[model samples]
Target: MSRPVDRESPDRLYTITSGRSRGGDEVFDAVTLVVAECDPTPGMQSEHSRILRMCQRPMAVVEVSARLGLPVNVVRILLTDLLDAGRITARHPTAVNSAVSPFASPDVLEKVLVALQKL
Candidate 1:
């Protein structure tokens, strides 16, 4: 069943005309229906791609924002969508280990400092 467009949501359904009849008397056209559900806004694809590139490891929202050079709010919105879609997973260090703070690991801290130096 087809429905009217929703103004608030990014999901959209549409039909495309595939081809025409050879005789061309009463043109026969094939209707291809598509249903896409996601943030279809401009630059969303690039944002998703960037997230996928970095999402292999658990990253904070601020880290993603800094890496992508995008505003924190924009990164939050995209992260929310990606999380809802199961494309990415969000993990908190505290959630994983109560005693281990972000700076508790000397090795990890050193690696992060080295990475920052390259930037």
Candidate 2:
């Protein structure tokens, strides 16, 4: 059986995103990787702190949403806050030339395939 989803109420989401419907100038996609730049400070929002701890290692935006039980759009807005505060850094996926090999090794390609399948 699947675990029950644990999403917060819309009101709580709104409060967390500060009434924003979308992220600021920074653009984020499902596969974009995020990493914490530093530990969250005292008095920081609980969500922000959680994100910091969760992102100590690189994590995709979609994975973050799944783990946090938050809507992707809401997560993007929250990420904007962290980006503005310099608490996190986002790395967008780069395009690979059709003529070039995308992965450096077969093992690397296999690992990426496994990760995508997990999602």
Candidate 3:
């Protein structure tokens, strides 16, 4: 017999389906598995919420740190907590091109390069 899903249980499974556009081809994929509980203390709820928001889109520690305006070390600590709680996950920069490009256009690139040169 199949095990019944426990509504009260924090541990639940989720299926993440995605499609990729590769050379005009549409490739579909699905990942299904049980995720661990994500219960954060009231004091840390906001932080956890922010991390969860970030996780919806793949992000690096530096990107999260910059977006949240938190120090890299602090972000790292928070990420560790989220990882332990199964609220967030990390991926290598190369494994996925999730990094938001600071420069998306030639004009923006030029400005950034100029600013870096001045610094």
Which candidate wins on TM-score? Answer: 2
The residue ranges of model 2 lying beyond 4 angstroms of the native Cα positions read: 1-6, 24-26, 102-119
Model 1 scores what on Cα lDDT? 0.49
Models 1 onward score TM values of 0.42, 0.75, 0.42
**Alpha carbon lDDT at 35, candidate 2:** 97
How good is model 1 by TM-score? 0.42
Steric collisions counted per model: 0, 0, 0
Model 1, span 1-119: residue lDDT tens: 98864522323111110121122112111111111233234555666767777656555666666777654554555555565666655544433453567666778789999999999
Q: lDDT tens string, model 3, 51-82?
A: 66655656556666677665444455556556
Q: lDDT of each model, Cα atoms only?
A: 0.49, 0.87, 0.48
Residue 38 lDDT in candidate 2: 99
Error of 3 at 71 (Å): 0.4
Order of models, best lDDT first: 2, 1, 3
> For model 2, how does the per-residue alpha-carbon lDDT over 34-102 read when each residue is reduced to its tens digit?
999999899999888999999999999999999888999998888988988899999987877645765
Pick the winner on lDDT between candidates 1 and 3: 1
Clashing pairs in 2: none
Worst 10 residues of 3 by lDDT: 15-24
Positional deviation of 109 in candidate 1, in angstroms? 18
